[model samples]
Target: MSTPLSLDRIQHAPKALLHDHLDGGLRPATVLELADQFGYDDLPATELDALTEFFRTAAHSGSLERYLEPFAHTVGVMQTAEALHRVAYECVEDLAADNVVYAEIRFAPELHIDGGLSLDEVVDAVLAGFVDGERAAAGTGRAITVRCLVTAMRHAARSREIAELAIRFRDRGVVGFDIAGAEAGYPPTRHLDAFEYMRGNNARFTIHAGEAFGLPSIHEAIAFCGADRLGHGVRIVDDITVDEDGTAKLGRLASILRDKRIPLEMCPTSNVQTGAAASIAEHPFDKLARLRFRVTVNTDNRLISDTSMSQEMARLVEAFGYGWSDLERFTINAMKSAFIPFPERLAIIDDVIKPRYAVLVG
Candidate 1:
């Protein structure tokens, strides 16, 4: 039996996000306003709706370069403290409206330093925005909490610096560290020193791997770098062998990943957009979820992919015929894999997530 999870139901369902990008999920109008304020005339579209369509199209072009093109404009305009705060605040507002009870948004601090703000200043501004956003959500009778992840671009040479920065801000609203950017030419191993620093300092981190590349990236992220969670680990599917009769065999790496219970932060729509997965139905999310490999759903970029947590869940339901139980399980998995303290994670699951789902499933 299947429970029909309509759009309204999906929107009201409690959700947890583990892999969202701050620069990639801007509001179109906000982008335009910031660009105008910053005097950035490089935007492809001046009109709001046209800009939205342009982003959606570029992201869906099935080329990674095209998919990342929109971030140039978003990040270009977000170089100031006020712009960063506004973007971060609006992110919380948007997620709360979609019933995201908890989220961890990641952005590279090195990219926003062009506006003459120190790395510390960038983080401070973003955290302040999150705090304000949470209070504002409370005023609206909604509950939402957000954490930031300081990211370093893999293709760049600032991983070590960013790692130390993440450790410095660990006590603040910054929850973890990460390395993002192109994965093919520049491997995660290039940032091994950063990962080791995080491990030595007892800090947590997630690595972008196996989305555009293959199992090698996944292997390094787990075996080499010790990623607490994987950003778009969908390509781990390549190691699995499935027969026409439905029998499945797991390869060595796949076996290790399953046995170790490494969380796979899979973003279905973003995967499709980057050609990481051919389509949502063909996505390995169902296989990974069935195997119980600590899989969690995420929206890699809301504005670029034109998705939200609710939309992601709704698409999964339509593609894989999932129900309320499946949705609840995904939410719980994400909550469990959060970078927050253990007691706090438990509190959210027991006190907030589970209860909210129970009411919906009832």
Candidate 2:
């Protein structure tokens, strides 16, 4: 029999990422150059290696709020359309190199207005970048399709407007809308009008829930705010109790997530860094996967966590002793949960994911 999958082998597997953040995955060199060119002078370190180490360590603060401090630098550099396009293009290049065949990248448009670009202008530049990135990657024989999810900060009051922006860009490379921020005081329901508008327009969205907060946040995301998916809904495990004999009892909320097949976008490395999961080994990923909760693996922020889809999958395989069958299942789960149209999702599954895994699973 073949040996356990190595990181190199995992890199060759076709992967789909549903929960990566655009601003959170900037290259260190790119960040430095942009900051210098755009005149944003808030970098903790001037050197690339130092700045990379800064982000790597800052994310390990073990508090979700504290872990987010490094973003100010990334967001500071990404104030202009040119910077946004370059970042977006490099993001695709990096993901394509990681063998991600499909991805849905989310960014808050309001965060980029400090550079004087309108909301639509922000979305347009990003969409154009995606087009060029895809074409360039195709030339290198690493064809990838990327979609955008316009995110609104939950603590802010512009969600209704951001939702409008998301829908406006639906026909152009954008797929869905999302609300993300510190999940404690700012609940998903705080933006009820935005969710309602999304539903009324038949738009799709995911809500950041159950990561920094608990089941209450998840419940509101589902019951009231109508989230199509839960971003970092790792705390849904709270609703499940396991005994010494390995008997698990599911609470009502856990049952709903599993029974309804709601996808939990689980990011293990980032989760550990943010104090979401205690550690990679203690992560509820195996428990929830065994319980059939429709959990999919992700690299929530590549730069902060120093992770890629392949690296995330490698960690899970080592931690859980999962084989190719398990990895294939997780990849399929993510592709299925993607916000793309049904036919497109199925095509990637049939054409790319299953074919690649078939050789490994053998």
- All candidates' lDDT scores? 0.92, 0.93
Per-residue CA lDDT of candidate 1, range 119-225, in tens?
99999899999999999998998899899899999989999999999988898888899999888898899999999999999989999999889999999999999
Worst 10 residues of 2 by lDDT: 1-10
> Per-residue lDDT for 296 in model 1?
96
Each prediction's TM-score versus the true structure: 0.98, 0.99
Candidate 2: misplaced stretches above 4 Å?
Answer: none
Worst 10 residues of 1 by lDDT: 1-10
Cα RMSD to native, each candidate?
Answer: 0.9, 0.9
Q: Write the per-residue lDDT of candidate 2 for residues 1-362, one digit (tens) a residue.
A: 25888999889999999999999999999999999998988899999889988988987988999988889989999989999999999999999999999999999999999989999999999988888999999999998999999999988999999999988888998899999989999988889999999999898999999999999999999989888899999999889999999999999988988888999899999999999988999999999999998999999999988999999999998898888889899999999999999999999999998988897676
- Score candidate 1 by lDDT: 0.92
